[model samples]
Each structure stands twice: as structure tokens, then as C-alpha cells.
Target: MKRPELVCPAGTPAALRTAVDAGADAVYCGFQNATNARNFPGLNFTPAEMEQGVAYAHARGAKVLLAVNSFPTAGRFDLWREAVDAGARFGVDALIVADIGVAAYAAEAHPDLRLHLSVQAAASSPEAIRYYVREFGVRRVVLPRILTVSEIKDVKKEIPCEIETFIFGNHGLMVEGRCSLTNYVTGLSTNMDGVCSPAAQVHYDKEADGSVATRLGDFTIDRFGAGEQAGYPTICKGRYHAAGREDAYYAFEEPISLNLATLLPQLMAAGVEAFKIEGRQRSRAYVRQVVGAFRGAVDQVLAGEDPELADLVALTEGQKQTQGAAGSKKWR
Candidate 1:
């Protein structure tokens, strides 16, 4: 059995080091700008910091992937171009991108640099995957979380590029890189602006019933009872009343995390070249714990042993875990 690479998230320079030290085979990060999707405050790296981070990870035998994954707006392609250039100059092992124009730029400007298609592209079918690989020479494609295990196996049989899939983290049910719920409220784009449910617009109100209502802008997202834990106010995970339903229901998806530790062998057998862990906006402590846990799991699985699923419930979103679309289409 081929041992798949463990690709981990590194939002900050410190988290990059933490992931490497914890046994990550590759650390993926982005600059602190709109060129990447996770462009939030207190996360991402500066150009100088990325240079240092690449040096540190390379010295430790870990690869660094720079994410220039966000789609560039018209007349703003220079920003994405600069980000790709910076990644190449800083010695990133690969550039993960989604836009065709940006991919074209990278292919022409830095032909030797590796290019991996980002999940934000939402390219699930072999035809879509083949288009990018043929047009831009993409080395790998990060499959969206919406595919089943059987579908992944079929995709692998047809696609030429390597496949990477998210094994753990937020279970995104909405269309990748095409969300507009946040913009409806904050007027900022999740794909281009890289801010989802911006913290400045999030508000929580305490009610007389000892329940707390979470709001993003003027829209109430979800209300948690006294004993329940109130999750962050993201539009997709929010509870809403629609179609005459008085009780608020999850219009997009419930607040649950994807933990596929048990499916590691199945994924490898399905011809996945790498396993990605989400949560680039997470803390260093989270980076250490999640990376370390998955490191041990992958090593054990590679050695023909049964990997134990780590109790990552506390680290999960809304403190709940699910197999997500990988296990079933029941979520749809």
C-alpha cells in the first residue's frame, strides 16, 4: 500500500513550525491577503515570514505549499500574480490555486514550480480535473468534500493528476468558493474577500429563557439553550425559518466537523495521494494536537496496523463530529 502524504494547515509561522515538528509531511499556508481564502486577522504569513517558514520546514524535511487559491477579480489579477511570485521566490514546494487565469500566469512565469488545484475550484468530475491538468499542467487536485468514497475511486481511475482530499476539519456542505450568504449580510465576498461571517458583524444576545441567540448583522443565525454550546455565527451553519417552518432549521448544513480517521485506509486504497487537514484559522495548540494525532494515525496505517481514531471532539466545530458527504448523501 502506498503511504499517502499528510498535508496539514499552517495559518501562522508558529503553526507552520508546530505542524512540521508534529510530523506533517507538508504544511500549506497563504499570505495575509485576499489572494488566499483564509485571509482573516491574526492568521496567514507575510512575505518575509513565509521565506523564513519555508526555510524552517525545508530544514525539517517537510514541504511547504503556498495557497494563492482565491479567484482574482477583474483588474485585480496583479494581487494574485504577486502572491504566486512571492511563493516561488520564497521556495514553496507547490502553489495551490483555483483560477484558470492565475494558473496560466503561474504556468508561464514559473514553469518549474509545482501547481496543485485547490478545493475552492470545486472540480469533482474527471472531465473538470482533466481540463486543468491539460491546460495548466497541474500536478495534483484537492477533491471537494462532496464526493463519496466510491466516486473518489472512479475519479482516480480517470484523472491523470494526483488527488488530495480533506480528512478532517469543517464539513463544508455549501458549494466551495461560491458562497454568497455572508455577502448578503456583510457585503464582503467569502471567495474574493476571504472573510466569512466577519467577526465585527457577529453579535450574541442573551434572552430571558436563558438561551443565547447568535446574529450576523441583523439576521439571527442560531439560538442555543442554556446548556448547549453556542457556535460561531456562520451563515451556512445558522438556524433559519423557511417554508413556513417556525422552528429554525439548518438551511445549509448543521454545525458539525468532518473526522475521517477511520477511513484512512479506504482513502489510500481509493488512490488518494495526500490527506489534507482543514482549520488554517485554528490556533497553534490546535495545530500541534491535530497534526500530531493524524501523524500517528497515518504512520500506523502505513505500517499495516489498525489506526485508532483520536478523540478530537473538543477540537471539532460545534463540538460535534460526522463522516460528512464521504460516508453518505443523507446530508443532502
Candidate 2:
């Protein structure tokens, strides 16, 4: 089997170093502005940090991918432009971009810089993927998390560029590059503002009944019973009340993580060029553990052996993990 590149997450410069040391072939991060998703406070890198991060990764033979994936607002196209410019200036191996404008800017401004289509672009079909490849010269496309293994194999046969798939972390059930619930609730757009359920608007209240109520702004997203783990107040994972059902339930999707350690060989055989881990908001410890485990797993798979992954259950969202659509044919 061909060895796929192990692309890992790096929310901070520290995490970037950690990922590289732990054996990541590449690390993807964003600026500390609205230019990328995972724009939570206390995360991402500043200008100096980005340069240093690029230098650090390059010194160790690891590539750095800058994420300029968020859409630029009408009057604030400059921010996205600056981000793309800064990424090229800092010597990022590639710029992971979503918006057509941003991709165009990068392709025109820095023709030598490689471009990877972010999953946020939601380019699943061959035609959609080909548009980016044709228009902006995107070399690699991060496939959305919704495709099954067989479906991804079929896509690889038709698309011209390399394919990258999420092997671990957030299941991302929502439609990519198109989330507005946070904007409706907190005036912050996940697509444009690069934030979802912004931490400033998140609230957890201890109810009199000992259960906790997770609120995003004034809207109560979910209520967790005593001893139950209260999840982050993301709109898609929130439970809601309905008339037919007496109890509240996940109205959009449940909170679960994607773990694809068991499918490394299949992905490699399917022509996947890269395996991405999706947690830029997590800690350095999380980066180290996940990257290390996957690094060893990929190596074992390439050697024609079953990978013995350490138990990563404790790090998963809500202590749960699933193969999602990759292992099943009935995901909706």
C-alpha cells in the first residue's frame, strides 16, 4: 500500500512543534483572525508565530499549511487578502482555502504556492472538485466528511487532483462552508467570522435541579442531567423539543467524533493522498497523542500489519467515536 501523508492539526505554534515532533508529515493552522475556521479565542498563531512555525516545521522536514478558508465579507476582502499574502510570505507549503476569491488571489498573487481545497468548500462531486482544480489550480482537495469509503474511491478515479480525507476528530455533520446558526444567535458567522458558538456567547448555568443548561447567548441549546457530560454548545449538536416527541432530542445531529484507524489500508488503496486530523481547537497534548497514534498506525499499515492504536476514547467528544459514513452506507 502507498503511504499517505499524515496531516495533523496545530492550533498554536507550540502545537505545531508538538505535531512535528510526534511524526506529522504536515501541520495545518490558521491566522489568529477571521481568515480561518476554528477562530476561537486563545487559539491560532500570530504573524511572527506563523513565520517561526513555518521555519520550525521546515527545519524538521514537515510541511506547514496555512488555512485561509473563511469567506471574506463584502467590505473586508482585505483581511482575506492579507492572510493569503502573509501565508505566502511566511513560506507555507500550501494554503488551504475555501472561497473562490481567496483561492484566486493566492493563485494569481503567488503562482508558485500550492493550494489545497478546504473541506469547507464541500466539493464532493467530480465536477465541483474539477472547478477548483481548473479555475485556481488547487493541487489537493480535502474531501468532505460525508463520503463512504467506496464513494471516495469512485471520486478518486474521476478527480484530477489528490484526495485528502479526515481520519479522526469532528464528524462535521453540517453542510460544509455553510453554517449560519451561530450568526443568527450571536451575530458571528462560522463561514465568514470563522467561529461557531463563539466562546464569548457560550454559557453554562447550573439549574436548580442539579442539571446544567448550556446556552449560546439567550438561547438554551441543551440541558444536561446531573453527572452527564455537558458538550460544547454547537447548534448542530444541540438537542431540541418537538411537538410529537415528549422529550428533547438531537434535532440536527448528535455529538460524536470520527475515528478511522481501522481503515488506513483501505484509504491508501482507494488513492487517498493524505489523512487529516481535525482538531485545531484542541491542546498540544491532544495533538501529540492523536498524531503519534496515527503516525504509528500509518506506518504499521504500510508494513502490512494491523495497527495497535492506544485507547483514544478519553479524548473523543462525549467519550464516543464512530466511523461515520466511511464505514457505513446509510448516513444521512
Clashing pairs in 1: none
Over 186-243, each residue of candidate 2 has an lDDT whose tens digit, in order, gives: 9989999899899988888998889998999999989899888655689888999998
TM-score of each: 0.97, 0.98
TM-score for candidate 2, residues paired by index: 0.98
Candidate 2: C-alpha RMSD to true structure equals 1.0
**lDDT of candidate 1 at residue 24, scale 0 to 100:** 95
Query: What are the lDDT scores of the predictions, listed in order?
Result: 0.91, 0.92
lDDT, candidate 1, 16-103, per-residue tens: 9999999999999999999998888888999999999999999999999999998888989889999999999999999999989999
The lowest-lDDT stretch of 10 consecutive residues in candidate 1 is 224-233
Model 2 gets an lDDT of 0.92
